[model samples]
Target: MGEKRLNERVLSPEEFVSGYQYITEYLKAGLPLCDVLKRALKYFEDQFVDSYCTIMLLNSKGTEFVNGAAYSLPDDMLEKFMHIRLFDGLGTCGTAAVRGELMVSPNVHNDRTWRSFANVVKPYGLKSCWSVPVFKPGTSDIVAIFAVYSKYSRYPTQRELDTLSAYNELLGLIVSNYKIDDSGEIEQLDLNEDDNLNSKTLYVESIKTGLKNGEIYPYYQPVLKSDGQELHGVEALARWEHPEKGLVPPIDFVDHAEEYDFIDWLDEVICRRACEDMKKLMDDTGKTFTLSVNISAVHIRKQNFAQRIEDILDETGFPADCLAIEITETSLIDNLTEVAVTFQQLKNLGVKIAIDDFGTTYSSLNYLKYLPVDTIKLDKTFIHDVDKSPIDRRICKTIIQLGSDLELDVVAEGVECDQHLSIIQDFGCNIYQGYYFSKPLTLEGWKNYLEQF
Candidate 1:
């Protein structure tokens, strides 16, 4: 690392900031961003080697990642890479989208997260990477990314930060001006409300797409009644061991049911797997505990909701009392008044409801008057902030008090750190769930996880 060589390899702040301002001023002058990027690369080439840059503007819809422009990139490479929609491990652009921040991949080839896109991005000798978020002027929603690249490993200087600041502000203006069109984003499935969709039919596909193919399966996240560290229950988390696509997390496709009115099948699939696992666990360990699965509003609206549960419980030979149904307030609202009668029927059969994502909505508290839930699980958003924000602490405290006064148990979800544990312990919320104890694991995995206790 000689002085002049190091100075040239790493960006000088003054140079980077000056270059940043020139690009912004150019864009503000009404030049299309692609043209502006092209001009900026030309300017940088005349000045420094930090001229290789890519301006990735998000589609008008925020759903997918799109590579719109790359300065100094081969035209063919740009066109080919641009077609890649954003997803986890989907190269630099998609990783940035998921983390909601600019991730610098100084060497995209060696970074495990971006390894899949290596061949596509490595040919340019792109060793240095810089990505800065372009956001709406006063909002957190990131509209795009202005990624600066170099042929060597480069770190940002003060001048580089200044350049990024100006670049982001200018890019924000361009993004805010573009109108979002979400057409072609959602594909509608065929079949009517009365049609009992076949498991093989694409229309019947829910988040758990591979259950029919035997790839989608249940994993249990162990829940301990804190302090005693005793296994009280487990929630079934679904995973897709895709043959070609690799492992997929629930956040990736868990909403397909709510999105396509196919939630019922997803709920049923997870329920069946969870009940079967519970039965096996009881037989093996002789320690039976509750197993909770989420129920969708889509299934609750069906006339046979109660009978459906009975069928599954009997089929699996699992105790009806050893199960809990979790539902969100939004799902509760989907058919609240009508479903209340059905929930009451299930309650008579010893099924308890835990309101998931509680306190995330304003209407959650009021629903206690209408629903016969046995527990109110505090949403993690409030728990995450319990130590920092006074408002969140007060609300959580009030919620615990409310649930206690209503004679319903309060389970604090996302109880990660000891601070969260201490806080809830003070609030008399004895039951807790979160990654600190353990992340969601397969039933076989849970047996190993339980060894800690």
Candidate 2:
């Protein structure tokens, strides 16, 4: 790719140092930031004649900019520019704030990014705008923006742009004063709390809409035989195809759904999709494999937990025995009797139960002795260092032995390379999963994977 060209004019070394020293003195003197902003804007405008200066800072949510201080800008324009949302093609300041880069529009009338907000600036006789995002020192978090608007269509000189670091330093010093106390405790900036809440609310609602629209679905990761030669089963993992954000990883929104009573419905969606994919694979290749779907503790606590599984199976025509419901060790620890009942009811319906993420929760394996689980999934920690650490190897060997004694299959997770595979197989784990075989795949990707056998 070609180097990104910025419209910058050169400034003298004395000019750059003078600007830096001026801002530094104000910050060191502990002047009120509002006063500092006014003085700073005037100083910048004096250096670059026929220019107006404005400052904007990110609200608590970090999605938009709030007007901080301005010099030589019209009162009418100031009111309209009070809040500028960060988005693609959202004018000079907004784009710079969102993209975390320097934005220079030599001609607002000609720039596509200025299309939406051109009229706001054109009326003020501003033809060019240069914006630089101010980030917190040693962090990517943008705290504010410092911009200059000029009457002529031109970009800042290279020498003038060199002072951006000084601008950022001053902006950070001022913005930090807005949040951090004398004791250095970060105080809540309630200025945009409602905006942040609204943004999150919309995001959560979008997930709900995505689920309804079938934009959210399952991606299958194969659980393989210990030697990594055959597909034993595939675990259904949820993924969201967000319109704006692209493919969002499950970690971003999985807990959001679980928190909002949406996971139960999402669980059904995953089950149905898994069933459909499995049925298609069977018809295409006549090969049948087990399917596992994770069940959250909240879902297990539901009164209709077992019945919900049965209903999904009957509704989707998925084989009952071919489906395994993975409940975590933490779930069983919470409501022992209730979970026992839930598992027993599921077992009666021929749905296999596996303890997911074993060894991470309680050290007590008392629940394992009573729960009717067909498999015990050893946590990733056991395999992460099993090859080099004797303790990890011994712990894994003991877990596999316990599973063997109880007539239960033991699955070792995070089996990444030859060492993990060799160590895990030696420990007698019945199945293993991780990058050694393959990472999770979409339905089409999994079909290609299953085509081998």
Best by lDDT: 2
Error of 1 at 186 (Å): 23
What's the lDDT of the predicted structure labeled candidate 2? 0.75
The lDDT for every candidate, in the order shown, is 0.67, 0.75
Tens digit of lDDT per residue, candidate 2, span 1-453?
011122222333345446655654554555666666777877777767577888876676677655467868854575555555577455788888877788899999999988988998888798999888877643557787788898999988654565454345446645765663322234434333434533453455556556766788898899999377787998998898887789988889878777655577777777778887787787778888889998887778877788878877887787899999987786667678788888899999999999888877664387776788898889888889998889988888988999899898888888899999887787777598888889989999999998776
Please, what are the lDDT tens digits per residue for candidate 1 over residues 296-404?
A: 7767877778888988888999998988988876667657787788888888878887888887777786679888888888888889979888998898898888888
Task: Please tell me which predicted candidate would have the highest TM-score against the true structure.
Answer: 2
Error of 2 at 234 (Å): 1.0
For every model shown, what is its TM-score relative to the native structure? 0.54, 0.57
Error of 2 at 250 (Å): 1.3
Clashes of 1: 2
| Candidate 1 clashing pairs, residues 3+ apart or interchain | 13-159, 65-86
